[model samples]
Target: MTDQPTPRAQRFAGRRVIVTGAAGGLGQVVAELFRAEGAAVVATDVAPAEDVVACDLSDDAAREGFVADALAELGGLDVLCNVAGIQQFAAIGAITADALRRHFDVNALAPLMLAQACAEALVESKGNVVSVASISSVMGQPYNAPYCASKAALLLGMRALGVELATRGVRVNCVSPGGIATPMVEAAAAGLPADTNWDLIARSTSVIPGFMPPADVAEALLYLASDAAASVTGANLVVDRGVVW
Candidate 1:
């Protein structure tokens, strides 16, 4: 087979990327994938680690500082992947204002703020952004009102920004994943009532029969952030295995 044409090189070669929530789970996977694809990656998380820049995204000063540090370290930024989020499950009457605000702060506001901080750099580099939303953003899930609302807001905000930034050559998109088999999902499931019908809730809407993996979502992000998707701004790529349907 003529050596299969020697396969092309990694897609993100020479690109500078910033990935938030890189300490674990989906964020960590996305960051590693970018690095594997030959991108210079600045990985940030709330907890400090030898391989991560610590920044609590809820704090405005810290968030801004993290962006500055990421840019300084990377020299330039071509892609930003906002994958940090919080999820909690509680009955409507049990949901506290603090919990609701926490979801919005981390899931919705932080992504928007990061996008704002990186806007100029993205414009200059003709870069792109990919945010991780949730399938619940489109289809409501019981006992997850706050989480769903926050993700919905994030999804719409990214779409609007995609429009506003198109002329500036900065593309923005979102990836909505459904029931990814991660520690985060396991923890969320553990918090649910013992009587909860997880079977019903986890049912797939597509032909696929199981939970998606973090890497599936990461690949969707890669496509949106890569030059391969040059004309695909203002879109939400649903990696839910057709769960919304």
Candidate 2:
């Protein structure tokens, strides 16, 4: 008898996926994980990678073009991971209109637009979406008014989308992370006070021994995008090492 072909890993094995902000940090890791797990990952960012498409998230034309090209290049899309975001340290009194708009454009509005464009394809594939919110959605943090507010809005948006798309078999979920060690964090750390108590903050937020690496956040996203999470939807998986609880 002829040998049979190997069984596929899951629905992801042949599916096309779109990951925004895919050039760096958590976005890069998340895109890589999906690719490793057998998805045809269309990694996208304003600054493209050799294997990714570069498109500006804030530009309406660029966002539309990305959706169109993603469909054309990948044949169709199965998952959308909205991992592009920006953060600013501004107290409520110090929050400028430009600063807040920039944060919202990247952190909240971009994801919503991407989702709107991909919803029809996702419904066709019965695929899911995973967004990257932050722990600040649930807890208060000083000197980050706009970032926190934008993340909170992202969480709510995920919930609403999950409900609206339920009957169509499209699931929407998000992951909230605390104190992830990315280049952005390194830059912020360089500006900290001489006596900043880093350990205290880590211990307070993370139930895990070390501060979370980007991979930790990426894996959480992979789970939400996988068939293992088939019954899961409208959930915000908080990977803060137990910070909010």
Candidate 3:
């Protein structure tokens, strides 16, 4: 039998990466994966850790502070992965203005604020950004108006920023992943009313039977952060198993 080929070394040997919401779930996976790939990873969440900083993304000042702290801790930053978000479900008739704004603050505004704050350093290093969008961004989700709208805004924001930053050598892109096994997913599932028909929603989405793990989405983020994607930018990679394609 022929021997198997040896795998190549990591692509982020000297890079420094920042991952938001890193205490658990997708953010945690992204941070761990980057560390595995040889990058100096700085993970942040709403709570503090030995290496992680407390970052309340809904607060604008906290967002700025977190961006600064990441650079200060890492010495420099090469990749900014915006994966912090919240999910709330409410019917259109029942959606409150506060709820909608809260979603935007956590999901859309936080990423934009971080990107803007890190622009100078990212441009200096010719770094890249990877945002965690959602399949809901492309397809309207029933009873999840705020979440869907926030994600949609995030997608467009990344696309527009990619175009603006391309000339400066800082690449920007987003990944819209389907239902992944995360705390957010569980929250969404639990938020459904007793009479809500999840099967109907799932059928409408038509996603594959299995749940996509956080690592599955993080791999795509790693790829975008690597030099292999040197020419890729302003792109929205849909990793939803053909959902929203």
Candidate 4:
């Protein structure tokens, strides 16, 4: 048989991209995929690698610092993928102000701030921003109030930015993947309390069984950032197999 076709190979040729949280999980997959599609990618994460620039997204000064480094490396930006976030499991009774602050700091605030910092360059290129939200953002998960709340904030904030940046031709959107097979999910699941109720947590699970592969979610990000989604802004593309659609 003839070689199978790649789905839009080199779709991002000549594009410059920046992916946060690029050291692990879905972020790693996203960065690699974009580069395969011919985009020049600059990657960063709190966990540094030889190729990944390290920046603690939770720090105020660090956000801008990372943005500057990313922009400088790319010379300009054509797309920004906000894949960094904090996902944790905590019981309501055990949750504290510090927990909420920590969740909001990374999951919600950092993405929004990064988008704002990159807005003008994106406007210049008519680029798009895609962030990784969560299925929990659309529906609450048991004992995950902080994680759910923070992701919900991210979803709405991106939608609002989509509207504000529309006049400037910069699209903004999110991908709320369902349970993904990633270290973040594994850690969160492992941290669940002994009294955790599976039935309750199952209520918000995907119609399609099992956790998705991170590469699958990366496809969603690529679609939203591609010209294929030129008219798709202010939207949350749920990749959880109809969990939130």
Candidate 5:
């Protein structure tokens, strides 16, 4: 099914939120859902969109600027949803330093940097951070060293933040999805090497078979960001159809 916001109530009424990568795919769905739930969202993405501010998340200056814009537009921060990421697959022999850096910069470092930029605001508002990790983070995925490594880093970083920010009244968590039916995933799967091992892939494949809809994964993210998860912190809620087991 296509991504659609089915907000049942104003769970985030009067909340000020920062949503990265809001231009398309799961990010777009997350932003739409937050707004539908009465959140004043400050959305940004590297890809230019009408309402999404252009911010190259890998750059420190741009991150600071985006945080500034968020604070200015929505006042104080109530939640930070780090939905921006890059997932490029490369076989072990093909993995390079540049590839590793590119993946970590966007997938892992960007989320951590954004959290640091909004730390005080989050603490002040007693808010939380919910990031989108990947099933590769908790499982070994072939031809995806960089993506997997970076996602693992993202998961650890969120856990570290969850502990560091807990006493400050700020929470941090992640939703590690096995796979989502997005253009990014489709392209990566299409570009896999011809000599790829199908049997090895099947070892960790989701029991549900195909990738999940973006909306389904987005729901997990929103749940972690909501007050319904008040006592939850440093948790990596896996929504990967039992892939990690």
Candidate 6:
């Protein structure tokens, strides 16, 4: 007897989604998750890849234009996943203004701008927004002042947006993850000073131990974007393996 092909789950079938930072580690996984669940996805990032739109999220005009282009292409938006971010580790005394600006621009401001741009469409569809925050938002980390502050701002903005949009039937939420095995984390680790105490940092934060895989984060995003989480809004789901606790 011939084996029957497994039917694919269609949680987001007939839905339209816009995923920013599509070229980044977590962003790419989030986009793929939406697409696999049958959503029409428009993925944008600073670097272009096949089917990924090249757009810099840091620029105001570029961000606005990207959202417009995405909506035009997708016809409308049902979900917005803000998954792009940058992490730079620098001692507070050594950090430059440019460094701080870069972190906030990409990590905090861009997500707000994208959400603002897509507000009308998302409201029309009764859609949702999911942002990838960080465990750093709630906990201090060595040489990561800018990153933690930016993520904190992002999380707060998401909560405020959730409350404001709740009356309109739009949900907004964020996911805070601990160390995940992503290129971004690797790059941050590589840039760390040789004298940094890796053991101490790990011992303090590695409550559950080991780096989480990107897929785990993607699954969290999927849940927030799916109907299963319809009643969930203004929520911050921590996927850092008990590190935050």
lDDT of 1: 0.88
After superposition, candidate 2 runs with Cα above 4 Å error = 1-11, 189-204
Residue range 1-245, candidate 4, lDDT tens digits: 99985775888999999999999899999999998999999999998886798999889898898888788888899999999988778778888899899999999999999999999999999999999998889887898999999999999999999999999999999998888999988887765788988999878877888889998999999999999999999988888876775
Task: Compare the candidates by lDDT and give the number of the best one.
Answer: 4
Q: 1-245 in candidate 3: lDDT tens per residue?
A: 99985554688888999899888889988888888778999888887765677879878877777777779988888999999898977666778899899999989999988998899999999999999998888888778889999999999999999999999999999998888888888887666656676765775464576678888898898888889999999888888876764
> How high is the CA lDDT of each candidate model?
0.88, 0.84, 0.86, 0.90, 0.90, 0.90
Q: Please write out the lDDT profile of model 2 over residues 138-175, one tens digit for every residue.
A: 77676667888899998998899999999999999999
lDDT of 2: 0.84
- How close to the true structure is residue 220 of candidate 4, measured as C-alpha lDDT? 95
Please give the range of 10 consecutive residues that has the lowest summed lDDT in model 2.
188-197
Query: Could you tell me which 10 consecutive residues in candidate 5 have the lowest summed lDDT?
Result: 185-194
Q: What TM-score should be assigned to candidate 2?
A: 0.88
lDDT by residue (1-245, candidate 5, tens digit) is: 89985547899999998899899989999999999899999899998997799999999888888788779888899999999998876678887899889999999999999999999999999999999998889878788889989999999998998999999999999988887888888877765778988888787778887888999999998999998999999998888776887
What is the TM-score ranking, best to worst?
5, 4, 6, 1, 3, 2
Displacement of the residue 150 alpha carbon in candidate 4, Å: 0.4
TM-score of 5: 0.95
Q: How do the residues 158-205 of candidate 6 rate in per-residue lDDT, one tens digit apiece? A: 999999999999999999998999888888866566688787577447
Off by over 4 Å in 3: 1-8, 197-200
